[model samples]
Every structure is written in C-alpha cells, then in structure tokens.
Target: MSELERRYHRLLRAYPAEYRRARGAEIVGTYLDLAGPERRWPSPADAADLLRGGLRQRLRAAGAADLIPGVRLAAVLAFFTATALAAVWSVLELHPPRAEWGVPNAGPFVSLGIGVWAAWLLAAVAHAVAPGRWTRRAVALALLSTVAVVPVAALAGLPRPPLFVLLPQVGLGLVALGLPDRLPASVRAAPLIAIAATGLASVNVLPRNDLFLSYYSWTASQILPGAAVVLLLVVLLLGAGLALRADHRGGWALLVLLTPVGLLFLRPLGGAVDGNMRGAPNPGWPVLAATAVVVCLAGPALLPLTIALRKRRRGPGPVASGDRCPTCGRTAERAP
Candidate 1:
C-alpha cells in the first residue's frame, strides 16, 4: 500500500469493526481515487469527515444514532432546570430571602431530602457521561433513595416537600425508565459537563426567593392568562417536534419534561386569575385545550400513527411454502 493508503487506513480505525469489515475497502478505494499521486497525508477536511462518519456509524450500531442529539438536549434541559429549582428551594427553606441568613435552621429531615436530590442529580450526570447497565443501576438506586427519603421525611413531621424538590427527582426517574439502553459515549459527555457547570453556577450565584410558593399558591395569581397560553403552546410545539424527529417514543419522553407543568394545570385557574377579567372564570379554557391537545399528540395519537405508517412502508409478509405458513408459522397443505 502507498503511504496515503496506510494513513487513510489508520484514520478508518475511528469506525466500528463490523462497519469497517463491510465497507472499509470501498471507502478506502474512493478516498485513494480522490487523492493526488504525491498525497501522503489526509487533509484536515478528510480527517474531520472520516471522524464524523465514524461517529455516525457508531450511533447507528447502538440503535440510537437518530435520537441521541434530541435526547441529549432534553437531558441537559432537565438537569440544569432541576438543579436550579432544587437549589433555590433549599436555599429559601433554609434562609428566607427577606430575613437574615441565619444558621442552617432546616432540620435533619430537610437536610436528608436535599441530599437525596443532590444524589439524584449526580446519578443523572453519571448516566449521561457513562451510560450502560451499571450507570443505569446507579440511577435506579439514586431514584429509590429519593423516593425513600421523601416518605420518611413526611412521616417524621417535616414540612410538606415542595413541588420544586419533588418534580426534578420524579422527572429523572422517568428519564431513567424511558431512555434507550445503549448510547454512544461521545454523545454523552458534553451534555453532562454543560449541565454540571450550569447547575453549579445556578446554585452558587442565583438569589433565592419564594418562587415555589408563588407558583403553587392556591390564592395568589402568579402567571397571567396570556403567559400560560404561550407556555402551553411552546410545550405543544416541542412535543410535536419530538414526535416528528424521534417518533412516538421520543414524543412520550416529553411527558417527563412537561410533568411539572401538567401538575400545575390541575390547580384552579379562577384562583390564579383576576376577578374583573373578561371570562375570568372561563379564560383558562385555552390552557386546558392546549394541554389536552399536547397530551393527545404526544401520547396516544402519535404512537399509533407512527406504528401504522411504519407498517405500511414496510409492506407485507412473504408468501408461505407448502410446509409452513409465514404469518402464523403453521403447517400448510401441499399443492396438488
């Protein structure tokens, strides 16, 4: 082999063994044909292209090449959002914003609850960085710890756990349940680091407030009707995007992302709206409608449609031979 060919072969090592076996020679031949006689090294563009192609093939082999980018985005959003909310909630519970930063007045149960959430967040980071059976096992254990701590704290007569504290843990558990079993490690690490950085900054720099109570208060009006409508619309659009790109499974995964918002919808809009507003009692119709539409599109409607479309595109089964039926694998009579 020429020097150029030898260098190309080394670069091709980025691809999986099976893929290299199947198409390596064809790819090498194409590259050699494109190169000049004096070429002895890969151009930067060629090296980059080979690396990109190799990563793509690896994702395909893992059965998540299509879903990794979307899932990674969703995971980062979930992690940072959860971490910020948890930190704010813990900070507020420990020291009221208007009051002095007193000693850590939160009881042992509160501390334990906070630790459980922290552990859950770390587990999510671990899974995102090194996804596999063992990382998944760690996530399961972390989820169980969060679940166990919540009930124990409640039973011990600690204050009712706030929504921010509970929502992220629940969402992580859902992600653990729904995420694909295998994913490329290259796709995992970047998002984990981004989430960790944002989480640290949010906890350290952001000021705490009664933000949780403001959102969850039964009598206090927190969000305006127009804002609620916009939020719901954004959720619906995100769900639709996931459905189109990753199909039904991805659509369903958005449910975890929207769970906290969905829970908020259960609260009466009348209490959260102005009394003199036009359709004050009924202005929330849009919110409810949007929620129902999103649920249908992301849940039942998308799954069946995807399945039907795939089946149609796949066509029908092959014809059965005399000894057996292809559809049911049963014995068939011989032709006369």
Candidate 2:
C-alpha cells in the first residue's frame, strides 16, 4: 500500500471492528481514489470525517437490544440529572453558609449521603464506559446500598430528612433498576459530561438555599412566574418540534425532563388554594392560576400535536390499487 493508504487505514481504527471489516476497504478505496497517487497523507478533513462517522456508528451500536429507545433515553437523562443533583447537594451539605445547615460534623447520615452520591456517580460512569453484566451488578448493588442506608440513617435519629434528599435518590434507584445492563460508551459520554458541567455551573452560580432548599418548598414564592412561563413555553416548543420531526423517543425524554417541574407546581397550587380559603397569607390566586394553566396546557397539548403531525405525515389516504394497503391493511378498492 502507498503511504497515504497506510495512514488512512490507521485512521480507520476509530471505527468498530465489525463496521471496519464490512466497510473499511470500500472507504479506503474511495479515499485513495480521491487522493490519487500524488497525495501521501490523509487530509485533516478526511481524518475528522472518519472520526465523526466512526463515533456515530459506535453510539448506534451502544443501544441495548432489550430496551426501547425511549426507555434508554430516559434512563440516561435520569442518571445524568441524578448525578448532577447529588453532586450539588453533597457540596452544599459539606459547606453550608449557616452552621445549622452544615453537616460537616454530622454522624453516619452525612457520610451515608455523601458516600451514596459518590457510589451512584461511579455506577453511572461504569455503566457508561464498561457496559456488561458486571456493570449492571455494580449498579444494582449501589442502588441497594442507597436504599438500605437512607432508612437506617433516619432510624438512627438524624434530623427529619428533607423530602428532596430522598426523592432524587429514590428516583435514580428506580431508573437504574430499569436500565439495561449495557449501554454504548458514545451515547453515555455526552450526558455525563453535560451533567458534570451543569453541576459545576449550578454550584457556582446558584445560592446555597436555591440549590438545596427552595426546590423542596411547595409554594410559588420561591419560583419566578416570568421564568416559569418562559421555561414552560420552551419545553412546549421543544416537545412540539420533537413530535413534528418524528422523534417520539426524544419527545418522551423531554417529558421525563419536565416531570419534576410539573410536580413542583402541583403542591403549591393545592397549598395556595387551601390557604386562600382559610384567609392565610398565601402567595395569591394569580400564582396558583398561572401554575395550573401552564401545567394543564403543556402536557395535553403535546398529544394532539403529535397525533396531527403523524396523521399529516401519513399523507391523505392510501392510493387506490387492486392490492390492499400494506400499512393500514385496508383494501385499495375501499379507498375514497
């Protein structure tokens, strides 16, 4: 082989062995044809293209055969979200602005919380990078450990553990239980890095109270209505776009992302209504009403939009022919 051809073959190492075996020669031949005898090295563009294509193939292969795409997407998103939240919480617990909030000198409960987060983070990393039976086993063990420790800490008389403290851990455990034993490394890397970056940014930007306390509240006082409206609109638009693009799995993942936000409003709406009836100093009716409107509109609207888009994509009725329509199983003669 010429020097250029040799270098091209080395670059092909980016692709999986099976993919390379099937298409490597065809790709090499095309590159060689394009390069001609004069060229002695792979161009930067060629190297980049090969690398990108190889990474795409690797990710495509990472999907577990047993799980649907939606479930896999949800699992990855949940893991990343859980990891980020746990990291932030751990940081806050260790370094609270107030001495009362700081658990730096606490007993097993503090250790348990921090240790579980570390374990969960490691489990996610292992599942992403070394997906196998062993990885699944490790995840299962970590989840079990988390479950076991939480109640034990409570029984040991740690201050009434906050609802937020348990909720993320429990949610993550459930997601981990449902996830496939193996996942593609390529698919896992993006979410992992994104969560890490987000966690760091949030720790730096948000006040300790917002990170650790405000989320646990059931009132709208802590939430900004304008920001909430903007977020709701963004999520709705994103969901609509996903549906229109025929990305049902992605749409479902978006719903998973929105679930917590929806729940956040639910408690406050109820509290505000009850408080108003009793003449208490509640946040007021407008806050409750707006939350209700956003929650009601965002979820149900996506369904009809999705159905309409799908029907539109189906494109009128099946063509008239002697044979039956393969997809709808309706006879062609019966068509309008």
Candidate 3:
C-alpha cells in the first residue's frame, strides 16, 4: 500500500472492526482513486471526513443511530436547566442569612459579575438566532465561564455553591455544546418563555427567605429551593416523556445526559427527607461527591445493558423479502 493508503487505513481504525472488515478495502480504494499520484498522505479534509464518518458508523453499529440528534435536543434542555439552576444558586449569594454564610448583600456588580447563569442564557439566545459556528462559540464560552467559577470564587474570597452542584451544571453545559448550530425559532422561543414563567411563579408562590438557608436545611425549611428543584425535575421528565413518545432515542438521550444532574439533586432531596425524619442535618458535600463518582462509573456499565434489554424487548425487525431468516437461513417470502 502507498503512504496515503496507509494513513487512510489508520484513520479508518476509528470505525468498528466489523465495518472495517467488510468495507475497508472499498473505502481505501475510493480515497486512493481521488488522490494524485504524488500524494504521500491523506489531505486534512479527507482525514477529518473519514474520522467523522467512522464515528457516526460506530454509533449506528451500537444501535445509537439517533445519538447525535438526541444529544442536540438534550443539550437544549440541559442548557435551560443549567441556567435556571444557576439563577436560583446565584440568588443564594445575594441574600445569605448570616454575614459569613455567603457573599451576603454583595451588590449586583460583585455577585453577578461573573454571571455564570446569564452566560448560559445568552448562549441559548445565540443558539436561537445565530449561525451554527457562532452558536457553538457562544456555548463554548458559557461552559468555560462555568468552569471559571471555582477559581474565581477562591481568588475573590467568595463562597460558591457546593462542588456537586457546579459539577452537574458543567456537565449540562458540555452536553449543550452538542446543540445544533441553527434550531427553529420556535424551539428557541419556548425555553426562554418557560424560564420566564418559572421565575414569575417562583417569585409569587415562595415567600422571601434566604435561598441558601432554605436549600441547606431540612425538608420543611427547604420549601423554596426544594420546589425549584422538583419543578426542574418535572420539566426534564416531561421533555423525556414527550421525546420518548416521538422517538425512543431522544428519550434515552435525555435520560443519559441528565443522569448526573438528577443524581446531584436527588442526593440533597433524599438527605433532606432523611434529615427531617431523623432530626439530622443534610448530608455534606463529601457524601454527595461520592454519589456523583459512583454514578459516573456506573453510567457507562449500565448503558449497554439497558440498550441490550431494550433490544430484547423490541425483538427483531420485520424481515425484508430475500433476507435470510435468523433461525432457518431461508430467504423471506414476498408479501402476496
């Protein structure tokens, strides 16, 4: 094989073993036919295209043909969730019950300077109206801003939210990066309106209390933050249910992507219930961190099993005419 052919083969390694075995020669030949005689290596464009194609094919082979689309859809949902969480969390800093508990009374300039939540909301707006590349840039900036919170808070002597809380927001931002460059205008408008309505409802229904205190205390004390978390969970479940009805892959995508966020929220919520019942304090960050780690580890292991089980439940697709039967190895008969 020529140098170009060798390099192309290396790139094709991104594909599954079975796929390469069946079509590797044909793929390499096609590239070779397009290359000039003097070509010593695959062109940059060709290399990228091959890698992209390989990844897509691999996902299809794994029964996730809709993974990318589902991820894009999930990204939008995640972005909205992350933004709302950030908004609620941001308020905690502005109104700490004690002088030392948070940035207590820190003016909008200092408290909202970093504006992690606003960054995500702006990204959503960009995604709604901007070009694809610009939308990606906006999302990337929002993600970087979220990561910057820790160091920024440390340096400024500010008390940020717990690590468990921030970690999942980061995860959501990362997933939101999968959002398509250009979504329909309606898609963009709906999330913003939903967020607005959430804000209004929160303002009207919940009394004026220190959000931070409410979030950390027992169930009865945590009414406001708890309600917010529950509402967000309900929105996510509704999205997943609607997606599942339309396309199974979309529902699964939402579930998988939101798993970390759900784990984070559930721990605190569970701790609150237990704390209330036992007259104990809510679990600390350490316990929550442990739960996040375990979920991260178990997620990969459980996904394939879940997919396999789903496939088993679905059984096999209808055999087309001339397709060999799994049991008898006889071609299927045509419909009358």
lDDT (CA) per prediction: 0.51, 0.55, 0.62
Instruction: Kindly report which residue stretches of model 3 are placed more than 4 angstroms away from their true locations once superposed.
Output: 33-39, 43-45, 89-105, 109-114, 205-246, 269-279, 307-336
Best by lDDT: 3
Candidate 1 residue 206 Cα shift, in angstroms, is 4.0
In candidate 3, where is summed lDDT lowest over 10 consecutive residues?
322-331
Predicted structure with the largest TM-score when compared to the true one? 3
- Taking the tens digit of each residue's C-alpha lDDT, what string does model 3 give over 273-302? 557667566665555566667666765456
Better of 2 and 3 by TM-score: 3
Query: What is the alpha-carbon lDDT of model 2 when measured against the actual structure?
Result: 0.55
The alpha-carbon deviation from the true structure for residue 197 of candidate 1, after best TM-score superposition, in angstroms, is: 3.7
TM-score of 1: 0.44
lDDT of 2 by residue, 1-336 (tens): 777889999999997787788889999999888885678889999999899677545433432111144445555555655565556545544432245566332443334466666676777677677765555676677677667766876776544324334443554455545455555667667546755775687567556453333323431233322223444564467557755744445554455445344533454554566576775555454655565566556754664465455546555433233332222223344434
Error of 3 at 323 (Å): 14
- Which lDDT value does model 2 have at 89? 49
How does model 1 fare in lDDT? 0.51
Q: Which ten residues in a row have the lowest lDDT in candidate 2?
A: 59-68
lDDT of 1 by residue, 1-336 (tens): 888899899999998787798789999999999988888899998999898788656544443233334443345445434433444434433422222433222353224555665665566576676666665566677667766766875666544444333533555454544344555675556445545564566456544443323223331122222223443464467668756643332343343345434433432433244333554653354554454455334543553454455546645543223432211223456666
